[model samples]
Target: MDTKKNIENISLLKEKMSDWRKLSDEELFLAVKEFEKMPRLEVSIYYQDLFNDPKFSKTLLDIYNKHKDNTKLVVLLVSAIGNMIQRYDLPESKEIYEFMLENSDKSKIGPYVAIFLPRLKNFESYDKKWEYFMNIKKMSPKKVAESSFETIMDLYLEKIPEHYKTEAIQYFNKKVEESNNEYGKQYYQDIINKIKS
Candidate 1:
């Protein structure tokens, strides 16, 4: 899919969202599902609207509560919220971030946590982020490489303690060395260099 086109569509949808009351529940649900399938930036716009609309907000929260036990629904909800937290400067962003951290299942929380790390200022207080990184070390190196890239970028941007920086670099370097993909290796190397410089 063309991510740029998806972004444009999201912009259009945002404009139309002021008139969302015109859309039936089925239409609104389908629109949200379609937006979720779009590029990450596009998904964020829909999520932002959901949070902004009183009706949609109630609907979404109902859906979340109803399907909180369904892993697929949980993944979709958490991922959508994560995309919003990453893409926009919304007023409820921090509350949403804290909610995800507190409510999401530990096994399925890594990706959402990785997405939030770069935007946050301090890493030391978010011990779960570090714990997630350490736990993922047991996975295959490819999984390790792909999974940790965002987390490493977050660490690079955040005010991580000096002691953690060394461990973070070593962890990223190990992933880079194990990564078979040249692009992935280069991305980690660039992050390492950026952090070191």
Candidate 2:
């Protein structure tokens, strides 16, 4: 599976990323283009390290924009943002959240949005994140089970009003019906059970 090539790419990616802090905007832009060309293997290996540097937050968003068409890369990038939000004091957190809220669509990374967005501090209630999830659900119920619904249930399960729990249970059940992936269906059912109990 091109392990040697992957190793070489990883080395090159690390080498380029090492100078990110010193690079000017112009140079960083050029470097980010190089990052866009990186395969998922190498990107996955280093994304957290890169993302954890709060200094790189704006650049990370730039890299995200560069890689939007690459869903796996986007997911890794989004997940990195998730990690950054939960663990670090990111100055760009609001901007990053706004960007994701505006540009994100129903794709593999969509659920990560649901998972991470609520975790951003001083924003809206769980209701806003739920609204985002519900909007996406309106478009694709199957996407609900991918990642966000579980996070939604976990985060808002207790915070939400009783009536919303009943509504969420209905959505979870719909997700179970719509998901063809056995694992995803099971996940939805589990959340339904959690809500019901």
Candidate 3:
């Protein structure tokens, strides 16, 4: 679906899912299990709205603990937990980070953890996190997978602070030069232009 349609769908879903906030812990896990069977984008839209409930963080971690062996769901859960950490002071953030750290060696998950794990400032100082994030050439992908180039670009575009924009653009330029993937090179150029403009 297009962006506008996705927003409308999420809004509609929010109306139905508001009751999800009030669900008991067990009930919430049941709800998550049902969500897991749905399309990824739809599941993402639903959980993105669901994460607004502070109570949901524990359930998110619980769900992670149960399903960490499922790499596809783990990616979604890691991203959700990362979003929750960014938006709230959840106690589960550290454990969630550790979980992602344990799974970071997987090809599909590594680039995502590389992108999202650095967002937690408690684990590392801001400068140190940026140093690590900027140095990961994998974050600027020559090949896209479940953790896609678009997703990585979007996260960097959304999360990059103003002070880091210049450094990010320079980094993108370097990736654009070194990458053999034509689409990846163009994507880097496009994002750099977006940052410039």
TM-score of each: 0.57, 0.56, 0.46
TM-score of 1: 0.57
Reference-based TM-score, model 3: 0.46
Q: What's the true lDDT of residue 74 in model 3?
A: 67
Ranked by lDDT from best down, the candidates are 2, 3, 1
State the displacement of the C-alpha of residue 83, model 1, in Å, after optimal TM-score superposition. Answer: 3.1
**Which pairs of residues collide in model 3?**
none
- lDDT, candidate 2, 1-197, per-residue tens: 36566556645654665555666655655654555444323334334454345556665676666556766656656655565555443454666867667545545556656666666664464345555655554433355544555665667666656667777888778879988999989988987887777
Query: 92-140, model 1: which lDDT tens digit per residue?
Result: 4344555565553345544444555435544436756555554444333
Q: What Cα-based lDDT does every candidate model obtain?
A: 0.54, 0.60, 0.58
Clashes of 2: 0
Which residues of candidate 3, in runs, are more than 4 Å off?
1-50, 87-92, 125-135, 138-174, 178-197
Model 3 weakest lDDT span, ten residues long: 140-149
